[model samples]
Target: MEKAKVYYTDMHTTFRENLLQKIQRLMKSAGIETIDFDKKYVAIKIHFGEPGNLAYLRPNYAKAVADVIKSLGGRPFLTDCNTLYVGRRKNALDHIDAAYENGYSPFSTGCHVIIADGLKGTDEAYVPVPDGEYVKEAKIGRAIMDADIVISLNHFKGHEATGFGGAIKNLGMGCGSRAGKMEMHNAGKPYVKESKCIGCGSCIRNCAHSAITITDKKASINTDKCLGCGRCVGVCPVDAIKTLNDESNDILNCKMAEYTAAVIRNRPNFHISLVIDVSPYCDCHAENDTPIVPDVGMFASFDPVALDRACADAVNNQPVTPGSRLDISEHIHGDHFCDSHPETNWKTQLSHAEKLGLGTQEYELIKI
Candidate 1:
């Protein structure tokens, strides 16, 4: 198989040619023009920073992509699935507000913002992959499933569980509905730490299945009733409900790979990863820590797995900055996320993604 072409450009421009222009050129060079966008519904999957997190990709980049799609006669809309964690993006209403608050309004991006899943994050369509590790089928947002083309505009950053969140993370975990997120997160029940439970009834209120009930001045989860949706974990005032710790990161990464494969199987797809911010954590967090390294610019590709692997390699090759999160390591040639977060092995996602026929780890980085 020929190496996947991943095009990149360094962040070097003053006033005339900005990152947005560079992205447009990069996409074209990466062969995104091959897709026929005429009258097609293009879903531009992106993370609208969770209200307070400042590390998400800029709206200007989204606007550029939307413009390109529109120029090709495609009807584009910025979309993201509702988050599972109790945060600003837990539902469509709140998620849309957060997107607008973060400056991704339809006026700005030249497209409407649609939370892929409907109001409660339960509106989903099952996409069968036939062969999968943890999930034989992916529960994707109905609107996302309905789109004619899929494009991921991802903010590549370190992830606490998966080592790093890149294009695959953006497509798999990012596109899954809140309930779908629960499936990828844990195979066992979510345990409620009674000590931290305030019995505020928030969990009981948010749980659609009434899985949580307060009793004896403490909140307890009815494991029998619980579907392991993980809603209680987010709504708890105290850090009470939590997923089991025994689950391996490799398992989680593999599940994510399968879910992502379900989204793009037999569909026209494109991906772009922005390596700016370089935060030590995912943008899903309420706050972003200082960057572990300097901004490396942007990359675009037709193959998401190849694009992600290329970006991870680029980040690993750069010298770690002093006073940053990765200040300890003298050696940075291997996986940077693993060195930064020793407990995580990111290769699980890459290798599993390749096995699932999503894409390959081998890629040729063509500098644009």
Candidate 2:
């Protein structure tokens, strides 16, 4: 495979130019304008940091991307799918509120925020994967799938499960509907916490597979019958039902790549990643620790695999921040992400993505 081009710019700001302007400049240099945007509906996928976690990207950066899309004659909307976990972003209403609370309002990003999956996280589109080994069809958020073009504006950082969350993480795991996430993270089954079940029967009512049965006013999920569509998890008012996060991190990474392929395949796509706030954990966390490394610059590319590889290389080259998790963790492996997460092997995602013909890990870093 040919080496992909990954554009980069340092985190240097002059009195005449700010980071936001630099982002716009980088995107232009990366050729985001090359896509036909006339009357196109563009999905700018981004994470609206879990409420209380300040590690996510600022709204201004999104505006920079959205503004560019509009300038190219496209209709852009900031979008993200609901979380599979119990959090402020688990459903559309709460997800939008969290986004607003985190400053992704229309007034801030110059575009409206849309929870890709509908109110209950049940609205989805099953798109077939070309050469899928783990996933046959990826359940993607309806709103994202409806878009004519896809743009990922990612906050690149460390992840416990996957060595790092980069462009693929944003588009892959981030784009999956609740059920799709279950398929990626588990073998399609969930257990009910009887103590937490209030006999509300929300799960029973939502279970299309008749996998859930209410006994003694408590819910019991039959693993044999359960399809793991994850609808029960979405409707359970008390959050008593939860999917087992039992997939190996390597499998999780590969599934994430496959899900991402289901999203961007046959669609015009672009990517941007800001490697700031280099947190040692996902932004899905409610609280953020000090950055593991000094803030690296921003990156943009048409090839997500190369973009992630470039960003990871940049972070690994930086000195660990004092008093941060990377500073405290025993640095056995030279790779900072591996040092931070000893059990995880992030290379699996990139290699699998490359195998799927998503993009090559080999890249030419073009500085703007």
TM-score of each: 0.88, 0.98
lDDT of 1: 0.87
The alpha-carbon lDDT assigned to residue 268 of candidate 2 equals 96
Q: Tens digit of lDDT per residue, candidate 2, span 1-368?
A: 88999999999999998999999999999998899999999999999999999999999999999999999999999999998888999999999999999999999999999999899889999999969899988999999999999999999999999999999999999999988888899975788888899998888888888888888998898888877788887787788988888999999999999999999999899999999999999999999999999998999999999999999999999999999989999767999999999999999999999999999999999998
TM-score of 2: 0.98
The candidate 2 region of ten consecutive residues with least summed lDDT is: 226-235
Q: 183 in model 2: Cα distance from truth in Å?
A: 1.5
Candidate 2: which pairs clash?
none
**Candidate 2 residue spans exceeding 4 A from truth:** none
As a whole number from 0 to 100, the lDDT of residue 242 in candidate 2 is: 82
Residue 323's lDDT within candidate 1 is: 84
In candidate 1, position 20 carries an lDDT of: 81
